[model samples]
Target: MPTSTRTVAEELLYRIGEGDTERIAELFADDVDWKLDWPEAEHGRPATPWIRHRSTPADAAANFRELAEHHVAEGAATEVERILIDGGDAVVLGEIRRTARPTGRAYRARFALHLTVEDGRVTRFHIYEDSLAVAQAFER
Candidate 1:
């Protein structure tokens, strides 16, 4: 028997949905490479705040802070639609029901994330999501 990568990924996704940033950090390796790609220039102001390129857990904490401060809102919710894991690699498909703060606008989007897990820790993370919709939500 072995530690199922899929199970690990599922727990990770669950923690994310729970808004448990500390638990999320505990799941990452010391030197984790996390990236959220949303070109600010093209996506506009709203998407600008959430985009990040972090190389460590500390960096991820900062990114999460920014997300919580600006992007994550009271009504925001995440649903994991699917998860596929092969060895140390995993892909998660999900949807976000988010409402941008201050403006209180709907910024719903679907997303897919690729994650690499080794020794029960996540080493790499890359996410793809609908940035245009987020930008549009911020439009005033």
Candidate 2:
């Protein structure tokens, strides 16, 4: 894995692929922050969406925890196919397959995530997915 931004991002992907939430939590800092290109509805909801995402390490940890939980029980599993990183940012191309969380409908969607790492943790993220496909799957 990389030691700087790229490495950190790879490690993050590794941990996620391995279903290692504990190690994933350790990568974040106390006052890490983030953003999203999708919307509040994708991750369910985040209370307010107008303000910038100012999250603590606990928040990051919980985010993964929720994802991990959902993946095993409710959501699809992510299958990473390719990844590229520069400085503290990364672009991941992957796909997901399984039942949609909360909707209980089968779906498969291609995804690309732009991520930024800082202090050995993910500080920002923007998610891009086939929303129309996801929505269609959820309806079935």
Candidate 3:
């Protein structure tokens, strides 16, 4: 029997908590519809480095890697409030806390992650968060 979308979403969350980039990439389809809901240009500055266009599973892994590179690992945490699943889609509501390595400033922001799974792999991934808070954290 094929894996359910809920199972795929749960596994993805588990792997993310484990910080397993390879495992996370394995959960994605080759060509994924990835989107980060943040302004590309804010005050004439470009978006964060990790906010690039991504399609392949390798790009997904690289995205996580870039995020880690930009933030302090210590005291970083994700508090998942809830997960709602229906058919092939899952919506994860959570808050993320991280300190920016560049400025050593910490920011906490609520997030909504939408994942669409099909054929046992995630085909679409979209995340909405407080971009201003995150950007301020990296400001000098």
lDDT of each: 0.75, 0.65, 0.87
Question: lDDT by residue for model 1 over 1-140, one digit each (tens)?
Answer: 12467877888777776666787777778998776667645532544555756787766666666677766466788888889888899999988887766566887799999999888878888989887787677666
Model 3's TM-score against the true structure: 0.92
Report the lDDT tens digits of candidate 3 across residue range 19-72. 889988999999999988876665224336888679999999998887888888
Worst ten in a row by lDDT for model 3:
39-48
Most accurate candidate by lDDT:
3
| Residue pairs with clashing backbones, model 1 | none
How many residue pairs clash (N, CA or C atoms closer than 3 angstroms) in each of the candidate models, in the order given? Answer: 0, 1, 0
Of the candidates numbered 1 and 2, which has the greater TM-score value?
1
- Model 2, 108-133: lDDT tens digits are 87889887787666776667777666
Highest TM-score: which candidate? 3
Evaluate model 3: give its lDDT.
Answer: 0.87
Provide the RMSD of all predictions against the true structure, rounded to 1 decimal: 2.9, 4.3, 2.3
Full-model lDDT, candidate 2: 0.65
Rank candidates, lDDT, best first: 3, 1, 2
Locate the minimum summed-lDDT window of 10 residues in model 2: 45-54
